[model samples]
Target: MILEPFPPALPYDFVFKLARDSHDLEGYHKLRREIFCEEQHVFETDDRDLFDESAMPIVCKSLIAGMEDTVVGVVRIDERSSGLWYGSRLGVSSGFRRLRHISPGVAVRNLQPCYAALGALGAGLIYKAVSTACALGCHEFLATVQQQNARFFQRLHWQPLENIMLHGLPHVLMRADLNHYAAAKKVA
Candidate 1:
């Protein structure tokens, strides 16, 4: 697929913040269904989960639209004493996915490049957990990188520690030391 150059400002909808509440939760579920269930074939999707009560949400907006713009992205973070562990079913519906990506709530790509971007930007639902981890002086972050996605994280400097089965998929235990990331100069 040819990648179109999306305007940065327009893509950002000129703002960033937490999801309002259960009010837009339907949209949130819709986006997740498109990516995690329909596109990647991840879960059978029972539609009920432990995180529903505690997870934080963040959304991206497209300026062309009105205030509610679009839910371009999302992430759910699980905070832990060892580190901040993050995961979520997310969709980059416009740039990637290719239409078929929004199939339903049972087939979709399990992993992608956006996770690291979410961590870096302090955006997405996962951003809050990342910040909380940082506040706790967390030096490292860990997650079960999908087997197919292990190479992607490796490219981003996350190191794999073990290959294991998680949620019916093979995943490599991966770690990211935020200290190294902090020392790197941000691109202008």
Candidate 2:
């Protein structure tokens, strides 16, 4: 009997970090517009708002073996008040979705990145945000997620507080359980 060779592994070294320079910042904005405006059709042309002026943006990138770094995902967090934080505008690249049969749970993509690396992209971003919030003395970390993504957050130990409408979309207000994700620990 003939045996098919196992597929070669995809190469990647993923990095999760805060936007440290103009390049990272510009990449983040471009990704947001690409996902939110052009792909999702949630917004007409752009999705920037006053919050972006103060929100801290985080990015997930894939370190290609011999290519430029690709930003595959992004999310923003802001402190609403003392010890209260909010996360929003979670976006993952379409390329990421095409790379792997990722759980509806995680999402992003580009530059021939590994499919496995994209699997944890969303959780990694959230973990970083939670860790940052904790470091900043955040008492509660909250986000309004789309209905389809509510269970994914639940799996990450976030509790759905209520259902609400935002920007004409169905969303659930969720709060991260510090007990479950305390330190922005890396996701395996």
Candidate 3:
């Protein structure tokens, strides 16, 4: 009898936290470049800017068998001034973006799922960054999100502030309601 090769193991668990070391930070940047520069063509070479110098990078790591494997998602938060914080460069690895959940009996080959679901990987990354910023004393949190993603942010309790053009693409200036993120201080 012929035996088929087993599919590669998929991560069934994930953890969202601050980038703990250089490796995590590097993965964050690499994922951002993949989504922003290569895939979306938002930036010709790199998406990095001066804000990256002071931004606190948060990462969602996929775990296999209780061990951390890769950064599947990332977002950065930076305090622009006293009580004012901004989030940017949110990205999820293409391979992991469609995963709603992983479990036994779920066919790995058919992993396509909507990322806008409440507990999806991208939502977790955004929540982590916003909560962390709130914990750091952010009274007002803002982000310039791509037009297509504005509704996603809205569902997360972010209010649209205005419209603007950035990197030659339409974007929405949105603000996160701090009340929704107040629990971060307790967890922090």
Q: Which candidate is the best by lDDT?
A: 3
Lowest lDDT 10-residue stretch of candidate 1 = 103-112
On TM-score, who's better, 2 or 3?
3
Per-residue lDDT tens digits for candidate 2, residues 20-54, read 78888899999999988898788899999999998
Candidate 3 per-residue lDDT, tens place, 139-185, comes to 89999999999998998889999999998999999999877764463
Q: Would you estimate the TM-scores of all the predictions?
A: 0.60, 0.80, 0.85
TM-score of 1: 0.60
Clashes of 3: 0
Identify the runs in model 1 with alpha carbons over 4 angstroms from their true place: 1-16, 46-48, 65-68, 82-84, 97-132, 135-137, 180-188
Q: Candidate 3, residue 137: CA error in Å?
A: 0.5
Residue 36 of model 3 has an lDDT of 91
Model 2: worst 10 consecutive residues (lDDT sum): 105-114
Ordered list by TM-score, greatest first: 3, 2, 1
Model 3 ranges with Cα > 4 A deviation: 1-9, 102-116, 185-188
